[model samples]
Target: MARKTSLKDIANKVGVSTSLVSYVLNNKDKENRVGKETADKIRKAAKELNYFPNLNARSLKTNISHTIGLIVADISNPFFSSLARTIEDEAYARNYTVIFGSSDENNDKFIKVLDFLSTRQVDGFIVASPEESRETVLGLKESNVPLVLIDRYFSDIVVNTVMVDNFKASFEATNHLLNKGHKRIGAIVYESTLLHYQDRCNGYLEAMKQAGIVDGTQFLAKVNHQSLQTEIQEAVQKLIFEDKVTAIYFSTNTIATEGLKQIKNVGKKIQEEIDVVAFDENLIFQFLDVHVPFVSQPIKKMGQEAVRILIDQIENKDQGIINVLLKATLETKEKLQKVN
Candidate 1:
């Protein structure tokens, strides 16, 4: 094993021309019409010899690599990790390979990943978490690159997106607390720039306004993505001690988990002293001593949908954007209480 297996090696074993083997392996011969028997033989030989086509060579010939690039922000996040698994599975099923890249919320890294994927000549792209703008996405669109947006989407750039309806989900979560006799409801939000985060804030604002709770000075707190736990804990203390917030709604998992830890750290009774509801569901539910409601997003569906959209675009070269706003479900363990 000095070198990897090649199409020529498989062709030699099958007693066929390299071009014939290439066509059969790549599935590029429509007029040549490869026979099932010949195709099967070629495939069997390739499999036995562990012959994998050189993607570069195949790409040069067909201008397609049967591969896709997936870019996500913060793959460490459980939500993104779960989505990545689902997308990889879907890509495997379609005989397409996937390469993953993480931006880590850095604009320069995001641009670099886009450039890398483009230079590699990936057949399509599944973009997960774009920072703020869609200049990169728009550039891909103009170049006729098959792109599928996932997790978060931008209205300005017309690309197929698969994500949960953040506004409605957050609204429902807020309304749940409102119906549960919680008047002074506080919120712990992640950073700005992300559309999902903004939608979540908008939902909270709408719910609070509808309840005629106008004074929002101490009711809202926004925490940066990094060092979220400390910032959220400080904000929660402010809401509880200074502003006297009775109950709190968390916008996402990272914030909710940290806020929960802070509440317990302060020796406050969760159910009795402060009630809580969260948007992102996690294993934290099992550890909680009291009933807590969580909004569950179909993360696996989002991943599968991203793959579907990308493959469809690659096959059909579709121009119109397909926006899929998946619905969210509320999982509640406590009885609903009526608020005055």
Candidate 2:
């Protein structure tokens, strides 16, 4: 086997700039920047010479590491894991590599990770949690770094973002339980710096208010992220035994799973004594003898669009503060068997 032909080969054969050849081949010539005749000539030369993008060589020439830095709140959480997987695949498809890390929702830890990845000269960043790193993000923006925020973002700063409508999704999910005649519902969520969680908590509050439930905000249980495992179980117990909530809404999968464990420990059956609703669904949840209605986000689409925007920012310097809000669906389990 022979070494594959490179972009430079095609550029040399077509008498065009290597930059022009790259833009055309990467489909980044969105504004028809390259004339049709010139694009055709480049393509013809590439095909004739069997030229392929030498990503490594191009990285050296363009001063791009061909790598992206992905910082999530916590990779152990299923949502972040799934999001990272999708982003990694999408970045690789665009001829880029991804270096991922978990921030554990700590601003200091997040800053360290960003510093490490930045030193590697990664071309861009796709951040899932920027709630605590607002200043750091602003610095990166000022430095002309390409960035795309997912999951959560800062409202004060203008940044490219891809997020689900958390307020609307949480409102609909809570209303789903309320519509089922569960007037007094409890919500278990970690109290964090993420703006999305605040929106979710408010959504639940709004639903309770709409149902004419008095002191509706009282049912919202916000726990510390560091002490969530203990705090969540205590909160669940309080809602069930003391407050006598007829239903519970978990704002994230971490809360949902822990809430379920608490419910089971207290010997309660879902949809019998109380109903349950959560933000994200997992395969293991399906096997549980419980009816769990969940809000499903378009994770893959979010990842693809974020990567596309970041690449655009890198190639064309087009960082015009794009805010893409995607819709989430409320999936209800209509059929659930009762456990004896």
Residue 143 in model 1: lDDT:
53
Q: List the residue pairs that clash in candidate 1.
A: 181-339
Worst 10 residues of 1 by lDDT: 52-61
* Model 1: per-residue Cα lDDT over 177-271, one tens digit each: 88887889999897778888899998988888888887553599989887777798799899899878888999988788889889998889887
lDDT of 2 at 271: 72
Off by over 4 Å in 1: 1-61, 338-340
Candidate 1 contains a number of clashing pairs equal to 1
In order of listing, the candidates' clash counts read 1, 0
**For model 2, what is the error of residue 298's alpha carbon versus the real structure, in angstroms, after optimal superposition?**
0.7
Cα lDDT tens digits, model 2, 189-306, are: 7677778888898888888888898578788888987787899889989999999998899998878888888888889987778789999987659788766889999999899999
The regions of model 2 sitting more than 4 angstroms off are 1-62, 335-340
Taken over the whole model, the C-alpha lDDT of each candidate is 0.80, 0.81
TM-score computed on alpha carbons, candidate 1 = 0.78
